[model samples]
Target: MLNRERYRGRLIDHIGLVVRDFAASKAFYTAVFKALNIPIGGSDERNLWADELFISTSDSDEVEGHLTGRIHLAFQAQDRAMVDAFYRAAMAQGGRDNGAPGERSYHPGYYAAFVLDPDGNNIEAVFRGASERSAAAVRIRY
Candidate 1:
C-alpha cells in the first residue's frame, strides 16, 4: 500500500482517469510506473486499476455518463534521471511526446517532461529539484 501520509497538503486527495482503451492504457501506465519504481497497487475487474492513478474505462458505472481522457496528471520523480527514464519508457510503449525533459520557470527547481497517453490524456514526470519536505510523512501506529 502507498503511504498516504506522504501526500499531505496536496489540494486533491486522489484522481481517476477514465480511458477509452483499457488494455493499452494499462500497459502504458504499468511500464512507465515500473521505470519509476512505483508498484501497481491493485486492479479491479480486469477493466480498472486502483493505483496512485485510478484508471477506469468509459464503461465504468461511475463514468458512464461522462466523457473522459482529457486531463494532465504529473507523477513525482525521485530525480531528473527518473523523469528521463519515464519519458523513454512511455515513448517505447507507444506514447507521444508533448514536451522534452527540462527545467521550468514554474519554480526554481521545477523540471518536467510531458507525454500524451494512448487515450490522449497528458501525463508528466516531474522532478522538483533538491529541497527538504516539511515532513517525512504522517505516521501512526495501527
Candidate 2:
C-alpha cells in the first residue's frame, strides 16, 4: 500500500471515478502505481480498485453522471525518486504530462509530480520530504 496512515480522517476512505476508457486508464494507473509501489487491490470486467481509489467505465450507473469533469488525486511517494519514477512510467503508459517532477511551493519540502490520466483527470505523486510522524495512523474502533 502507499502509506494510508497519512490521511487519517482528513481524506475520505475511498473515492471512485468513471473513466472514458477503462483499458487505457487501467494501463496508465498500473504503470504509475508500479512506480509508487502500490498494488491493484482488485478488479473485474467493469472496474478496478486499489487501496482508496476506484475506477470504472463512464457508462456505469453509479458514476455516469459524474464523468463530465476532471478530478484530482494525489498518491503518496516514499521519496523524491519515486515521484520522478511515477512521472516517467505514467507518461510511458499513455498518461499526459501535466507537471514534471519537481519541488512545489505548496510547502517547504513538498516535492511532487503530476500527469493527466486517460480521462484527463489530474493524477499526482508527492513526497513531503524526510519527516517523523507521531503515529502511522489514527484508527477508529467500535
lDDT of 1 by residue, 13-47 (tens): 55777777788888899889888777675656544
What TM-scores do the predictions have? 0.80, 0.83
Question: Candidate 2 lDDT, tens digit per residue, 7-79?
Answer: 3454577789887788888889889889999878767766777766878886665456457478899998999
Give candidate 2 misplaced runs (Cα > 4 Å): 1-10, 61-68, 134-142
Per-candidate RMSD, Å = 3.5, 4.2
Question: Which ranges in model 1 have alpha carbons more than 4 Å from their true place?
Answer: 1-9, 45-52, 62-65, 136-142
TM-score of 1: 0.80
